[model samples]
Target chain A: MSSHADVERRLGELLRTHEEQVISRWTQSADAPRDELTELYRAILRAIEEGGRDLADLRGLLAELSRSRARAGYSPAETSKAVFGLKGALYEIVVAHADDEVLRGFIRFARLIDDLGLFTFEAYAEAREKIIMDQAEQLLELSTPVVKLWEGIVAVPLIGTLDSARTQVVMEKLLETLVETGAEHAVIDITGVPAVDTQVAQHLLKTVFAARLMGAECVISGIRPQIAHTIVTLGIEFGDIVTKSSLADALAHAFRRSGVQVSGGPATRVTVRAEQA
Target chain B: MERVPILKLGDLLIVSIQVDLDDQTVLALKEDLAEVVVARGARGVIIDISAVEIVDSFTGRMLATIAEMCRMLDAHAVVVGMRPAVAITLVELGLSLGGVRTALNLEKGVALLDHVRGAVP
Candidate 1:
């Protein structure tokens, strides 16, 4: 049975001599590639050496390792094992040199390395959350595309919930697109929006009013039966803004405003603006 | 007194605000506009606020106040030519000019008022 003093004295030599063996023990079934494992082990040893009392020195290294693993599509279990496996390697050293003191030393080592493993997990979760949030924002931007259907008509087909942030993006993008396209008519289609409440109605109103202030006449289309019913039940007056049953209807209304008519048959007719009574 | 000019064209009052307005100027314009509307028997007021770059909370309230006054005096009020940035700012500030009608430009505003007038009686 080796004493605590004996274990401490032999720690440096034990690590240097049995480094490869310990690494081999830890990397048994871990999915971390061999090259990454080698670099990671080197970093972990340096951190434990430089940070004798605490794992503060390893914060940056662990954070980067966890984030990289997360980005590389490693599962949480795989990422966690990547750190926990190092603990196994460190334990092997304790088992070789120390006797009765081995248990005490192993306990302290486990506490420190376990904390570091937890840090890696936290970092992995944070990086994954950031990736998810960024992807969601990109999807929102992509879905809210402003399509110029005709010379003077631009349409925005809104999908998903109209949260405050999304509404701001929608309004800004629609206004900028309206200016860029020089479209006098804007069709805001809400077919993809699942529901309409007061807040959603307010967002739509704000967007329509902003477009109206920009010299473009806005017509809201894709007013599904349920959405219309919701609006009426809520007493949310969409007031003078033209509401249509579908995008085609809105487009028809826009064409009519520009003095053009759309018919179901192939034959179409253009009405002069002079017919306005 | 730096008052926003109010030009009476027939029964319509056209207010083209071409200068940056201080609080005092805005207040004076309000009083002057109300008096002119009453005196000239104006049926509609088209306020062109295109030149004013920013409509902070105070300016936005002033607009709402002017529109409310027009309503009380039986005159229709239309705010025209509000810049895109200004509109965005107003919406962000959460000050919706609920009582005021808006148009893209002065011409459209006047046309809107005429349409309203024709529809009313």
Candidate 2:
């Protein structure tokens, strides 16, 4: 029976060896092509699959392997791809043994994988920090934006700050969803956002512009006072983006914009004249 | 482009919120709006949100807080123009508006705000 500490030591050694192999594979003369690097990844997975592996030991081994891979001239672009591939593999393993406690370790391992893969890349430190600064930009989360219908209208409730990266994701996803669902108007409620800097504000403007480009009207709701003040101070204009106080207000606005009216209610309308930029 | 202005209709103020409500301009407007509501004795408020793409929990909580503060100052708050995707995420993350009124656009929201105010009597 191998002691737990022994297993840990062995796992560390394995990781160190894996690291060395990765480094050596990359540093080796291209004149002598080494296709074995790919094979090594497979071998590592196979080793993990065979028998009751200790979590600590496996982590140790994998850590060293990742370090070696980084040491071996792994370019940043390649690093991102590798991270994705590793994530796929880890996802498979976690899904395969969903309820197993021992597999819990693998799930934890999966979460840490991004830290190892992305942060370790000896690339632009500023770019890395920027990507990690906002949770919206972290592509690690698995979420597909979808349109939901309520009372014959489409509503898209925004729940996070719009960073440039996330803005791109939202724009792409919203456009795709809008076209797919044939939503004529989109209501975007932003009562949840805390603060808006100039760049973040610009990113939202771009989204509104993108929505119009897709032949859909976008409505903005949830104007907290702090946000209102910032907009005035920064002099950022939202001439084209339609905004309201709440989702209900947006729906009413949409009804008026589409010329649809609910029966037996007091009709209220506000004429909005966009100030010239 | 000039920033979206706060449009007042009757006792309610219609604020069209852009996507970048987290920026400095919006931040400054918060205090200004709060003061205006308190001083003006506005009975209702409607904030339009058709332009936003993201609204994290921090911002979401702030809006809820704003609604609470508005009520204390004798104004009812309503949020509108929420995108479906963002709504899904906010729900998944377990965020609530804490009883703030919501609408789809400025027109319907204003109507509802008026209704809510009328009903309050």
Candidate 3:
């Protein structure tokens, strides 16, 4: 069993590994400028020492470190190297402590700087993921979709807002589930959604796109009036997307399309008549 | 999601998740779920999402991923206390998560897994 101390040591080692990856990539990449290497290096070291500290202290520490490095008579190039180095270290630190909100805060800060290299990509991806798993579980009691059949076609009903984080999840799940279940049609009913935003709408579109990639039909149902308005106002065309007024409607569409025969009249009367006949 | 420290539960693991279901929390969910599943060979995972108002795309994606991870590790993941609004929003957002399983509340979710021995064979 690995102890907390072991985890910490692994984090340090990860920092070194990330630094090497960053430096090696930069050295080989075409049009890679050499002016900021020193600054990056210093930033990496400072970040390591203060990686998971309090936010206020973290800011102050970074500022102080920058000033001290400047006072040490290093050239602009050297300062840049230090900063990039710090970014590389921060990248590793972010991955190691990616679950920490404090580390996420630093990633946000790094986003402000344009020259963050691959670290930015890694940080944002990790930060984005951390935000979803941690925040969603805290705020909502998210239920994982269970496979259920509606009219012989598999129906995976999702009940929640489609935020960026959850959108990615739905896309992945829909694909994997479809492959696993071998269901031809999937229905996403939204009668439970309270509101919609442009970003959330985009996430929905992405899910539809992903479902198609898996060679399955994705039907979105239960779009409320407000959601409709939001979509229209946001200039989001649901043309490529199939939508129904409600879950029932979506189910009906899916069923009809799948060539399932609708039962005539009521079940009780039909059973009695059949027995008598 | 608000993440509490890992709570040991005999052979099970209970991690209380705050209701913030966003991108960052999703990453945490993946990390925590992976670690818990891999290290302890957790028999059951109880995810408390009662605080969440909405399950965004990234969040939805991460949840699916966690469920998949649990199944791979011969464990079951039970999502507890999803708000009605959150559920509705996810549907409207057109997120289709298949293969993930859920229980209405923590008690049921946990109970459902207590008698089970992992993923369906």
Candidate 4:
């Protein structure tokens, strides 16, 4: 154990003495950029000078490098390989010296490099997971959008799998928009929703009930034939809540309930004809 | 116990709950509202909870009870100005406040009352 410590100290000294050669060799073998490798090499030397036991500084530098590489679309193998490159560079120095003490130290140093390579792999994976989470949150925001279709009417066009969390968001957004716009009518269009199970049906029912409790009427529209059949088979009752076949039907229902009349005049017909031409 | 004030507007009674409702306060408001609704022979009752932040099951039940009592007295009850969080909490708590009318705000509540009265008579 004492000899192991001695070898570790000798490896640190060897690294300092042959700093330029080690860094150049390391840079050539590493997949990372030249500047980053130089910075990481310096950080490792600083950490070694501090007592070699605390590799926190070196780990921080490696973690930062791996994170950036992860964001830049580098693969996990490539990122960890960049850290492992240090072992090969140090092994060359040990062989040149041809000393048993330095060779033992090189083995210890190789283990340290292996630990760092694993750390880099973990950091890269974490960064990739964070990116996936952020995109998922953005997708949630993008998919559930509540827009005003008319005065006293708002529409929430749901376009994905209806889960509890998504439904909760949709319900809240729709209710808030209702209060803001003073809309007595709301249209929840499920045209973009691909499937509807019992759980999805329950979520829809809860949302409608919540809207109704807030003193607004909700009309669910865009029910495809398959979804309609599924709703019947699932034995899910919408229960007095109006369901329409399309968004247009829902909007027309909303307009009728809100006392709005829509009739196309001759001027509109002429424009339609011109557009067709 | 703090009392929630009830203001009468023509044939309608407006009760806006401005404080955190404990059991006693909710009960007192229910009694006071019942008395006012009867004395005024009010055609509609609007209970506004715009400022209410938190509600337990008891308070939720009281709202429904008051609405039911008003209905028994031959008056329409409309709950108004419920915040999004309160509404969500009530929904999560499984209290749909069914059979009780709701409105977005005081103005809408009044409009709804007028509409209901017009439809009935």
* Among all candidates shown, the one with the greatest DockQ: 4
Per-residue alpha-carbon lDDT of model 3 for B10-115, expressed as tens digits? 7777766664556776777678778877888777787767677666777877777887888788777766555544554565666555665554455655765764
RMSD per model, one decimal: 6.3, 20.5, 25.0, 3.3
Model 2 agreement with the true structure over B17-113: per-residue lDDT tens digits: 7647664555566666798797778888877766777877776777677778788898988776666555544544566453676654556567667
lDDT of candidate 4 over A73-135, digit per residue (tens):
889898898889898888888889977787777776777778889999888878778889999
* Model 1 chain A lowest lDDT segment of ten: A4-13
Where does model 1 exceed 4 Å of error? A1-10, A29-31, A52-57, A67-74, A99-106, A179-182, A213-215, A258-277, B1-22, B31-58, B65-78, B88-101, B105-121
**What value of lDDT does candidate 2 attain over all alpha carbons?**
0.61
Better of 1 and 3 by DockQ: 1
Task: List model 4 lDDT by residue over B13-37, tens digit each.
Answer: 8898999999999999988988898
Using all chains and alpha carbons, the TM-scores for the candidates as numbered come to 0.72, 0.35, 0.34, 0.91
Ranking by lDDT: 4, 1, 2, 3
Worst 10 residues of 3 chain A by lDDT: A29-38
Quantify all predictions' global Cα lDDT against the true fold. Answer: 0.80, 0.61, 0.60, 0.87
Candidate 4 chain A lowest-lDDT run of ten: A265-274
Sort order, DockQ high to low? 4, 1, 2, 3
State the fnat of model 1.
Answer: 0.40
Using TM-score as the measure, what is the rank order of every candidate, best first? 4, 1, 2, 3
TM-score of chain A of each: 0.78, 0.46, 0.45, 0.88
- For each candidate, the DockQ is 0.39, 0.02, 0.02, 0.78
What does the lDDT read for residue B84 in candidate 4? 81
lDDT for each residue of candidate 2 in A95-123, tens digit (9 for 90 to 100): 54454442444444455555445543544
Inter-residue clash pairs, candidate 4: A215-B102
